[model samples]
Target: MFRATETFATHAVANQPEPADPPDPWADDPALRGRLAAQGGDAQTPAALGAAIRDGDAWALGEAARRHPPELRLWDRAGRRLDEVAFHPAWHALMAMGLEAGYAARPWDGRPGGHVAHAAMVYLLTQAEPGVCCPMTMTYAAVPALRADPALAALWVPRLTAAAYDPALAPVAEKRAATMGMAMTEKQGGSDVRANTTRAERDGEDWRLTGHKWFCSAPMSDGFLTLAQAPGGLTCFVVPRWLPDGTRNAIRLQRLKDKCGNRANASAEIEYERAWAQRLGEEGQGVRTILGMVHHTRLDTAMAPAGLMRAALREALWWCEGRRAFGRRLIDQPLMRRVLADLCLDWEGALALGLRVAAAFDRGEQAFARIGVALAKFLANKRCMTVMAEAMEALGGMGYVEDTPMPMLYREAPLNGIWEGSGNVIVLDVLRTLSRVPEAREALEAEWDAGAGDPPYDAALAAFRDRWPGPPDEGDARLWAAQAAALLTASVLARTAPAPVAEGYARARLADCPPVPGALTGLAEGAILARLGGAGPAGESE
Candidate 1:
């Protein structure tokens, strides 16, 4: 005797879909290898490393990132001042992985395409765990600033490039690896480092710095690059945590910031009372010396949004592919396909744009790079926030909670836009270059013209170039930035991507190509899907 609803059976626990160990995302991504090849880098290392991240310890590391955000330990047990930050063992593991993969110092590899290779590697690694990239990126960017004082660079470079992870706070000689941090911002000047109030003075041929830095990132590092006012003018200084005599410096940690995201790395407020420092560059030349490092950081910051979007897109697509609703897979629906395709366009375009800027660095074409980095940073970071939102929506209720990676991705979305420089600052940088720098427009126009294969592209390029070569004002900076980004992205896509991708980009983005979602309209059942599609659904396994 059984009812229609129940036939002598009891309920069982429902097993939701979850993401498994992914295969080598790098080997399958021809685009990354292709980009690397253009720069003369060997893709074997990156491909192999990509497989390791996917098939190896990414999940465990990600759990550590989630379970144990960094903890700041300010004092030792015996009432001595330690001023240290303690991270989960997982953070160190992630850092070791990043360093071992050569993402940290590959730009200085003395190869033909080191910067490009480094950029591609960084772009991929950030997808797995973005929090640890902070310390590593700062360390990577610090090389140029150190190069200003070659003697100082000679002292620090070898220690920094070591792949081993040595977390114990001790003398550099005792550590297997070293990292660097920065402290330019104060409560007063955010992006305006020129307004810094920290003072540096000559102390028996050794410099002593005295002031407060409002945001000191990765405070556990062996050294820091800071800015202060000296007798001559604004000067850059290198402040080590330990003196040459192995004594602690006068630096004191105030408190760590409660940031909205990036929880795994410590951002501290520090006070310096005659803290020991060595001059980095000529007096009154702080900006000129530090600008190189800042430029490199901006390039990396621009890539973060793209990496984050890719992470989100993968998670969303995975959920859609496996879950069923309305009698079929959610991905089979027309609206969902349009959304995924739109997401794909943005993600791929962003990746292409980021790699293009990185290539500019490899080529050392400073003029082209100046304008290109600005446009890419402003445009890509802004779109990254929106793309993450759309991705979360595609995942529906699962995306709204802590059970999936979508929420984490969403929280970190706005960071790239705000870091290094905000949207307004970046746009102003672009305009300043166009208005003041000679040959700036010329270089940009050349990049724009490279995309013109038909009347529509030409017309768009004309529209873009027409807005330039005139008086610059902040009122129209966003419009100018958008057009510049679109033109540059289209130029790159037309040059590198396949015909269908170019066609899809043109039809969806440029409004030039004929509407043909008819065949391109499939719910991701092709090579493009394989490239941008996801693994299994995302959730923690029991």
Candidate 2:
């Protein structure tokens, strides 16, 4: 030993290879191509874009994985009030790819499955990167609200639909494309936009705004849709970074929020004094004007958690299959298999229902889509946290490290439930809409009709209605929303998935107490893993 200078335990348990990024995110999706075509999308272009999003070249995913988050520059080198946000090159590259891929413009394209196609594209892209999706979602959501004023719509919609991503803090007129942000929260109240104290004054047909926003998201966007109190009451305005004359407006930057997740994008707090603005719609109707935009954004919020679950589950299963433990592969262990199977069941059901609502947007089911989005957001977003924790457990200690994407995914899992509307806020929203919008109940009824073929699902729906009674109220909104989402998802699976796969989902998921041993015997792990890579359960591809 002294002669050879041998080393001991030099290669203790060599670390296994982490799962690689899919060659094509679009193609790996078990559901995207058919979902798009079923909704009438010409899937050729989006399918092609999938390979780019998979980011085999490493440029896009590399940028997103960089150490630094976006930074804020309050002043320029010459001591001017630049109020700019400086981003790493990775953020810019990822954003540019998404804009060019048409993630923000599909709904406005007016093609068959326009909304469905858009939804599918965003679902695929966000799995690799979530923060960049914020600005894109805002740009997409702002369309309907801006259209409330025909002149404003004519001015902004074309630019928003443009395929270029210009990050420069310059005049909108000078850019080939634009993005949008929203500022609705303040110190006094969070979701209560009615409590806003920002003041607006009339200056000819234009207006001036002066107040503070506790949370002004996507601060670098070219324009913002904000709310302020006017002579008429809470009013909506389009506040731009520059005046028509090309001078920087008075909307000042306070500080960027130090958030736990979503570090790739900048969220800020800011104040303004006489920021020149254009009124969006009738005064005193701010809530009414922005309601349409909220619906769309909620749909985006719901899509995000479902996408995250699919990606995380794939990684968990891949690790289980590759790693040996207790004299056998980890996936061969019964307990590990049970946890992963449960995850797959939830992921498929959530994806199926979420896409159906997205299709409803395409079909103009405004009444059904509105309430459906809330139900899904409340339930699916909550499930994301549970699933992330379970997946991390399946990987043991290594999954908790930042080297893998699991830590980032876990940090982001709870955010969707808190965004747009917190869990309780969503429950109340379900109640508020049930009392106001007749179609809220109709959405549930639609699911019942779709799933009558399965006895268990039909029985579950009956029990759900009995528990919820007529319209749900503040007291039982959580119960109502939970059962409604389960019923809807079960119905979806029963109608479209194979009988064994669908029934397994319902038996394990809808039970009063989840059975101790649940296995989806007919649903193969390879088929579920392929969903994360690009094929459906039926093995079709783009």
Candidate 3:
């Protein structure tokens, strides 16, 4: 006992930061509150959900789910074919909570600001756990795609929009609720979905599909909206997990993808050996039909990066406020203040622009929504990697460790950028929208005009027009997208953000700010940092 006591005494912990407590995501974030209100969304649902997440130990659940990834159970003990994925209990719990809170069902509830509210929920749920969001997002987005077939929509839409969660393996009609998935990409085509090789043949009133899917997201869903080639060219179809006769479909799971991130969710490689399916849209309209789902999913992809940035920054700020270097807190250092203040601009701009796009969706501004979402997704995701890296660096060695959340956030940063569309795809889409749709250009100009009074923004807009009187060369599409997106973000911030925040963004991002982080000349650091509201260690101001 004496020897053990003497050995342990020398290894006492000292000056280590306490674990970051789970704060109310809705209550603690003034930016979220302001943006939600400005977008005409009520806070009651978000507030309640945020509190429930915090109180229900969602932080621990998220950690557990990621630490213990889902497992693919290909066969049962009896050796029968079973293409089922088994998830950790934590994953199931989070899914249940999200579905109950209307993560997938809110926008279809016939309430005002339904889409705006759905966007807010996306932002909030992403902070707690980004992995479990895949199924919920697909389920939410599938409502629109399903509408292409009124009969199918009538059968599936209610189950998809029901405020309940059912993970049973029965027919969708037999379950209390249902979730939807998507299987679009194949080996030959990533974004060039028009080149898909899947074959669909008419079988009586329904159809049968026979092809392989390279990436099938959320493979355990009750049904999937998939694409295949028909006699009339590519077409969209609804492939169920179970046939209407109550037996498993002929869909075979090849293997789950070993991804760099999003471990808690399952992405699969699968083959459809004459799998029964229902046509979702008319033949040869697959691209146009599935785009309805793609459009809405892009909104979540835009908002998720903001949520990730917010989560990482909160952790970094908490660590800095609690730990000290050279007899003063790390947050009190000049360099640290500049770094954090610089990071805050991206978060604020992203939040503002995303919610603004959601408001457009609510108001049925299709032209603006089409172009605005691409800009928001491209810019926000690009900034997310930088913010996540810097925030992790702020914590030094501890941030790299799994004990903290930085590693997960860093892994997840690039996912949204790659999902729905990569950077190049998004840039091309932006150019296409401007070139083909006159209303898209007008909508963009109208948005820029809303915040035209700012001197820096005005100069930038003039330069942008002069630089590209017509669309730039295809090689310069990325440059065009980046500058245009930044300008659009500045415009939105000028109208929605606080005075100092907006002014700083316009001066730094729009004018002469360098490409590097923490390279700043003049910014209201105190006011900028104040937006990340919380008390420091020992009740000190952050």
The alpha-carbon RMSD values of the candidates against the true structure, listed in the order shown, are 10.7, 10.5, 10.1
Mind giving the per-residue lDDT tens digits that candidate 1 earns over 168-224? 667776677789888899999988989999999899977999999999988988999
How far out, in Å, is residue 359 in model 2?
A: 0.5
Q: List runs of model 2 lying over 4 Å from the truth.
A: 1-9, 12-15, 18-22, 34-42, 56-66, 513-542
lDDT of 1 at 55: 63
Q: Top lDDT: which candidate number?
A: 3
Q: Which rank order by lDDT, best down to worst?
A: 3, 2, 1
Q: Would you list the clashing residue pairs of candidate 3?
A: none
Cα lDDT tens digits, model 3, 1-542, are 12222225568655677655678898899999988898898677677778878887788898899889988898999999999999999999999888888888888888778778888888888888998999999999999999999999998999999988999999988988999999999999989999999999999999999999999999999999999999999999999999877999998999999999998899999999999999998899999899999999999999999999999999999999989999899999999999999999999989999999988988889999999999899889989999999999999999999888899999999999999999888888988988899899889888988889889889998998888777767667777777777888888888888988998888878875224233342555555666788333454443
Cand. 3 Cα-lDDT = 0.89
Using TM-score as the yardstick, the better of models 1 and 3 is 3
Model 3: residue 210 alpha-carbon error in angstroms = 0.5
lDDT of each: 0.79, 0.79, 0.89
Clashing pairs in 2: 27-534, 28-533, 28-534, 29-534, 30-535, 30-536
